[model samples]
Target: MAPLENLASGRGAFAPSSGEPASPSDGSGQSVGSGSSGRKRVPLGNSSAGGGSTSGNPAGDVGLGGSSGQPGNPDDPFILPQENASTLDKKLKVEVPMEIVVSCGPNGVVLHPGGYRISPGALKGKGAILAKELRSIVRLRQQVDPMIRPRPSIEFLVEPGGFDTYHEARRQTVISGLDWPVSLQVADTKVLDFFPGGRF
Candidate 1:
């Protein structure tokens, strides 16, 4: 168990439901702060020798292990504990893999420039046409060109905070594109960040 997990028992570090957590001292020689970043962390040896209390690791999610998503709060999609994204999204019925790369204007889905031959700044065009296409792309996330093997990202400007209802999220999708099916807008994002449980 790493130092970041929040023990439901409130004793201390919790073993991630997933697997191992990340350790800050791996290279930096800087120890991970314990007890919610305020209290002192007992040395790993001492804690284990005494059969340890729970509040041992304080690195949070990272200490839990590899990032498996797990966003800061409910509004975000970081819930899972594994990073096998494509497969994970399918299990969650999320439709696609997307995240907020930038929380400001022009922050659209990033077509990861790998294996695929598509060009950036080119997928971009002038005015509403571009926005419309992007909006359309979002709508058709369930269906993608199988030939375009590269994984794609889908980003939606969440309601300043979060979607109040399923209907609201759907309605916002429509309204965001009111000007051109993909109008750019500002979204207030909550990025609290819990450590990934590793298997998400």
Candidate 2:
């Protein structure tokens, strides 16, 4: 027996089996025994179902017997198609708020804290949305000015061109340029008031 160290080190290496002289090749090339001396490469890639490599079987489609190139080369390899963020976001589908606008008419009453719906059924289409504003005015009546302002006015006018004060609204009644002092027939100004958030 060669020294295990010498056998391991490849230093004057001894043959694997005793008593048999070294052949043309030391038997590591193909089949492992003393009889066989060469290798026979076979192309049996078509045996496992004709499409094994090209048949949509994901794993078999690679270079099984080195027939094709490397496994991941784009030419022979199939990579899963993927969607980018925009496509994926559309696929997943999330809604996001963009902007907000504040108005003082039918929708304005909702901005203030403790705002309430006018009619309990307003949201359900049974009553007017302006109910809250009417309720608020009924609660606070001292601020009412009956002279230039209409009684129970749903909204005080800023006098069209834009006035900074109530006194300005009181004094500003000019219709427009080329407009005479002809009295304008107007409907009684009573608008339903509804705000959101305050209780009924």
Candidate 3:
């Protein structure tokens, strides 16, 4: 039979009172730590000698084998693990220069440089024209293109209070139609002022 101290601390298997193996608990019918089963509850930190325990592997315990070797408090749920700065930088870096710009407002969808307007009604059918025009302008293939020099930086500005229900759909349509990199932003007058000619 296992010692009384071992049984109380849940260190050893349940000991039987008679020659037959004992059921989980004493005849009182109450389980350890309010468990329906008659087994005693083991502490979170301890592991059995053979590496078996009621709780899972001790390595994953709150603080022991976390990113840092410090012990984590099991009570605190909001703790955020530290992340590697270099990994974050690599994930956030932009790989390609933006080459498509779109400005959407209540007035209409306006293509930059030439300020071509596509009315809301015509947006469904004529939207592809904007992408085609931008491609031509970026490639410097247009006969009367204002941007004679091709620049790789392209940005899209969607004005606030514009294209209420159709905004996202129209924006995605323009994005999917373009072959080059594109950036989208929701800008007010103040942000637009930062553009070269105070136009976004």
Best by TM-score: 3
- Which ranges in model 3 have alpha carbons more than 4 Å from their true place? 1-100, 139-153, 163-177, 188-200
TM-score of each: 0.17, 0.20, 0.33
Error of 2 at 172 (Å): 24
Over 53-133, each residue of candidate 1 has an lDDT whose tens digit, in order, gives 344533424422413334465444555555687765555553334322212223233321111221224333334333344
Candidate 3 or 1, higher TM-score: 3
Considering lDDT, where higher is better, how would the candidates rank from best to worst? Answer: 3, 1, 2
lDDT of 2 by residue, 124-180 (tens): 243332343343444343234321211232233222222222222112212112121
lDDT of 3 by residue, 23-136 (tens): 444536453454666456666545554543335455443443453456667556766656799766555554434355567777667766667676666665544655555666
Q: Report the poorest 10 consecutive residues by lDDT, candidate 1.
A: 111-120
Alpha-carbon local distance difference test for all models: 0.36, 0.33, 0.54
Evaluated at residue 103, the lDDT of candidate 1 is 24
Q: How many residue pairs collide in each prediction? A: 25, 9, 2
Model 3 lDDT-worst window of ten: 141-150
Candidate scoring better on TM-score of 1 and 2: 2
